[model samples]
Target: MSEEEEVELLLTELFDWYGYDFTNYSRASLKRRIIRLCSLDKFTSYVELRYRIRTDTDYLKRFVEEITVNVTEMFRDPLFYRTLRTDVIKNLAAKPFIRIWHAGCSTGEEVYSMAILLQEANLLQKSLLYATDLNPSVLEKARKGLFPLSQMKQYSENYIASGGAQDFSKYYTAHYGQAKFDTMLAEKMIFSMHNLVSDRSFNEFDLILCRNVLIYFDKNLQERVLKLFDDSVGPLGYLALGAKETLKFSSIQSKFKQLNKEKIWQKIR
Candidate 1:
């Protein structure tokens, strides 16, 4: 069989046996990741990996991480965070309680970024942050709140560029080649494994962020997930996308108003 056909069948079996729904992910990108996985693990073909996942639960867990892992950093795209701080946070401060969901939040950098933002604004006490990803391994890393200390210099610059009011270094302590973020940032944050493709929205949120995530999905999955996000956000709530992602191609495009210079959108009740 051709490689394309093999991957299609692999995706099907992956869903049927493992309950993972990656069939609608962008075909080229998904194929690249899977092929890379096969190369890394010395599998002759995609079917070999699929067969292993079918028989070994541990292999399945690793496969999930291989495909879903994404690059992330604290206060990534600093300008976006700047816009959020100046434009979005002020509005959220008026709410008695705020719920924010960092959907597809790989490794929880942005989740911690949000916590620090709220903490500075004095809004952290009234806020609940849900940071979720499809892979449990990434969520575990997020829960630990440990990152490479070598990256602290760059992250600190990003924090300052993102309108951070205090010393970014104060948020984490460096030791043993790692930086462990303060516990207070994790206090109101909940980390969980949530598959955007197969899972339903769990709660209504004042803001939903799925940054740099949907670009991996096909149009159908993107629309499906956007609708799920739309339903999950309350009236007059906000949605933030990656710089390259937009509501222009979404099913609920007309319902949002782009308020800031960034990608944040408000659901026009």
Candidate 2:
């Protein structure tokens, strides 16, 4: 069999062994990540990689971290956060309290970004933010609320563009070339490991931000995940996707009204 066919069998075995269900992920990207992992670990072939995965649970956990998406930063798209603050937050403010889910919240930058926005809006005190990712390693870093000091400059710029003009430095203290954010924002967030491919939604949310995450999945998986998001959102709840993702062709497309065709969407039906 070809290497591609071996990958297919390996993915199935991976699911059966670890319950990750990577079978429906976009084949090209998943293969790339797997190949990258194999190369880094000095595996000569997928057969060797598969052997290690089947026998080494501890190594599998580490392997899972490498394959999953974790590239994220605070206020990733300034305009998206700008739109949330200007249009979405006010609608949420009318509520007695709010629940926001930051799905795929790698390293918690954008999750804290949302928390900071809510604090500025005087809504953080009344909000519960759920931040979830499939990787626990990143989640641990996120829970600590520290980011590299080198990143603070760019993050500050993003904060300003997202309509936060305050001294962004005031939010975190610098030590040993790293910036640790205050616990005030962390207090309102609950971080957990959640896999979109294999896990079901656990709660109804007023707003769900799974931004930039769906682009990695195949259309079938994206459709399933979109429907899952649809079911997880409460009536009139909002969803903010990546600039490149949309509900336009999904089965749940008509059920949601366009808040912003490329970014924000509202469940109307």
Candidate 3:
């Protein structure tokens, strides 16, 4: 079979054997990642890769980790966080309770960043942050709230640019090569596994952040996920996407209005 045909067969086997679906992912991106995984694992042929995935449960976990996008950091796009602090958080503060969902929250840096934002605004006490990802391994990392100590300098700069005035180092303690974030920031967080391709909305949220994730999905899947977000967002709630992603021309475009130049869209209808 051709490489493309092999990919189709592999995706089918993964769904049938493991219940993880990548069939609806963006074809180009999925293929590239799959090919890269194959190369990184030194698979000489498609059959070897398929056999390993089919027979080895441990390898399956690695496969899932490799397939999903996990490139994330604290306070990504500082200006976006600034907008969230200035515009979105202020609106949410009016409510008695705030429910924020971080969909596709890979490793939880952004979630912690958000918790810090809420705490700074004195809203963390009344808020719950639900963070979900398809891969459980990343969730486990997120649960630990430990990040590489080497990255602290950049994250501190990001925290400052996001309008934070306090000492960012105060948020975590450094030991060995990792920085363990304060447990207080994690008290309000709920981490779980969720598949956007096949899962329904579980709760209505005041704000839903699914940054940089939809770009990996096909147009049909993108629309489906957008509708899911629309259904999950309360009236006047906000939906945030990545710098490259947008709701324009999607199934839920008419229901949301973009806030300035950022990718955050507020539900208007």
Model 1 misplaced regions, further than 4 Å: none
**Candidate 1 lDDT trough over 10 residues, lowest sum:** 44-53
How would the candidate models be sorted by TM-score, starting from the highest?
A: 3, 1, 2
Model 3: pairs clashing at backbone N, Cα or C within 3 Å: none
Worst 10 residues of 2 by lDDT: 256-265
Arranged by lDDT, best first: 3, 1, 2
C-alpha lDDT of residue 269 in model 3 = 99
**Winner by TM-score:** 3
- Residue 266 in model 1: shift from native, Å? 0.8
lDDT score, candidate 1: 0.91
Summed over model 3, clashes come to: 0
- lDDT tens per residue, model 2, 7-62: 99998898888787888888999889988998889999888998999999888988
Query: Which residue pairs show backbone clashes in model 1?
Result: none
Q: Model 2: runs farther than 4 Å from truth? A: 260-262
- The true-versus-predicted C-alpha distance at residue 247 of model 3, in Å, is 0.5
Candidates' TM-scores?
0.97, 0.97, 0.99
lDDT of each: 0.91, 0.90, 0.96
- Which ranges of candidate 3 are over 4 A from the true structure? none
